[model samples]
Target: MSAYAYYPGCSLTGLGKPYDESVRAVFAHLGLGLEEIPDWNCCGATSYMSISGDKAVALAARNLALAEPMGLEIVAPCAACYLVLSKAQHTISGYPEIAARVHKGLQAAGLAYAGRAVIRHPLDVLVNTVGLDAIAAKVIRPLTGCRVAPYYGCQIVRPYSGFDDPLRPQTMDRLLEALGARVVEYPLKAHCCGGSLMGTMEDIGVRMSFLLLKEARARTANMVATACPLCQYNLEAYQGQMRRAYGEDVTIPIVYFTQLMGLAFGLAPKALGIQRNLVTADPLPVTV
Candidate 1:
């Protein structure tokens, strides 16, 4: 059994509670142990970086410092947390000045990180580390009747290649397939979900979300499986807004890949947090 330092970011504890629950449930089902990083703080998401690069790096590095002692790779379930942590590590390692400042910030917080810990997203851990064959072996209830659109949102694969092709990722799609789901061809899989733009610019955010949902519906997908909490929230929560704005009723359940995995693993629906979903009209087509 492989162990990892799990960093469930702010959103996961809040609006993305189901994602957090499903992540732990799926990992436990797969015999993967996750140690929660002690005293973890916010990753600063997309806001702090825009305000101050040095401070943002420091904030992200603080979490890395916390995980370094665990001596295991850190797996962040939230896409924004993964990106922020990855970007901070890359920037701090590449630039001496930034590293120095981040070190100082860590010192102020009574923490120290030597960049020994590697940051990874759950998708990368599942497909690359856990192996699809191992996952397929544990699928007790195959998702044979479900047609899923695997949505990758924007951050997980981008600016940090190697794990997958950023433009056309197939990790989630392949995993769903292994679970006996009919994976729909999602061309806009890597497109942005407007991120914070959904809050700052409602019109643009709703429009972008509508387009993605529209594409998924066009392909006859019953539900969209995502690896990012923000993407799940945006796509699921914004359907009514999109309909009011564009007169297109695109209502589909946006579920976390972990939730799907849990179902396939024969875990109870409540354990996977399926009931916490905002959009409950189109429930997951999985049964115990």
Candidate 2:
């Protein structure tokens, strides 16, 4: 009915700024609106989940409670935030003890949680709510020869995400096809991108990302399109790490799906934050 309450999470605001821009740009091009939820706090990502489930849910609860006033669905672009927020909602709703504790925690900040906030991913909103045919009509330039590998990573549709089938997600594949790009059949679409494990376990993470890039390249995918910032970072930033692991080079530009949408809409590359990426997305030719 109205603009979504945008939640940037830590990654989107810090490391994933381009994603945030492109998501806004594509939404604007599609004639949709997104209003950032004011004074939003962290969803605690995966870090707090291991230490304390209650505190992490409380952190996520605060953001959900804040969105109550806006009365709009919360669109979280980062996959980790999406999962954590969804988990928080489930945890709060399923457990009366958790609900009571989180409610008390929110009350201390002049806030309350009635579980009114509806959390959604940008992909879910764009493809489901906005519709691909509607998006296709807005494309000023079609990605004629661009071969894209749709990587859903491990979080977006996992556990609680209801928008798409988690194991065999086709939302991105279908959306990219609408943009005129060949969607590479990626077997590792839902595979783990090593996520924070890349930081904590270095080589293991690099090798995992290396597999995704290798597969995309093997399938003749010129670039990898993903909805998660951490997936983009791990895949794009770590191609140089495990060169020995791959018999052949596995370097490919990993980009947000929204950037491709912007290109199809004739939006500027700079505006989509293409230059912000470590691996130059120079090969994705856009005919304006």
Candidate 3:
């Protein structure tokens, strides 16, 4: 079994707790092991970069430094964390001056980052490392009748399109199909879910989320499967507000892809934190 250095960013500890639980449960069910990086810090996500690019790279580099000694590729479940870490790696290697500043920051903290550690999202690990056939083999309860809309939500594919197509990603679609789900045609799969704007710019955020949810519903999808914590939270938690804004009850259970994987793996709902979601919906019926 291959092991990865796991990095669960801030959201996973709080609003995305269910995602954290399901990711762990699903990976364990698949015989994959994850080791949390020791003393790892924040990835300085979207906000930090806008304020100060150098400090943002430095902040993300610290976590990379912590994981370098382990020699395992860092697998982040959070989209923001994955994007930030990947961007930091790219920036440090591409520019000499920025790399020097990042190195100095690490030195001040008595750590050294060689920019050698690989960063990946859990989706990348599952599809590329774990393999779809292996995942399909473990599906004890096929999601036969479930119509799912795979929502990638902007970050994982873009600015770094190595693992999947930037505009039209099929990784999640293919994975869900392997698990026996009826994957729907979701044009807004890679669209923005407004990120932190849901808190600051409520109208714009609600509208963005509503459009995705509305599109999924229009396609007759029962649930929206997401790989990003913020996407899951924004889509699921803001449904009531979205209804008030849009005058339509656009509420569907926005779930983590890992959570669905756990269900398909025959893990109990509690183990996958399925009941923890704010948007309550009947659990997807599993085929025995």
Best by TM-score: 3
Count clashes in each candidate, considering only residues at least 3 apart in sequence or on different chains.
0, 0, 0
Across residues 41-148, which tens digit of lDDT does each residue of candidate 2 receive? 888989898898789989888899988888888999999999999999998889999899999999998997778778999999988988988999988788888899
lDDT of 3 by residue, 137-183 (tens): 99998987789999998999997748999999999999999888999
Q: lDDT per prediction? A: 0.89, 0.88, 0.90
lDDT of 3: 0.90
The model with the greater lDDT, 2 or 3, is 3
Model 3 TM-score, all chains together: 0.97
- Candidate 3 residue pairs in backbone clash: none
What would you estimate as the lDDT of candidate 1?
A: 0.89
Please report how far candidate 3 places residue 133 from its true position, in Å.
0.7
lDDT of 3 at 105: 85
Q: After superposition, how far is residue 111 of candidate 1 from its true place, in Å?
A: 1.9
- The list of candidate 3 runs beyond 4 A from truth reads 286-288
Q: What ranges in model 2 sit over 4 Å off?
A: 244-247
What is candidate 1's lDDT per residue for 1-288, written digit by digit as tens?
A: 789999999999998999999999999988899999998999999999889979899888989998988999999989999999999989988999989988988988788888886889988889888899999999988887789989998899898645889889989999999998999999999999898899899899999999999999999998999888889988989899999999989988888999989988889999989988877634455532
Between prediction 1 and prediction 3, which has the larger TM-score? Answer: 3
Model 3 worst lDDT run, 10 consecutive residues: 279-288
RMSD of each: 1.3, 1.4, 1.5
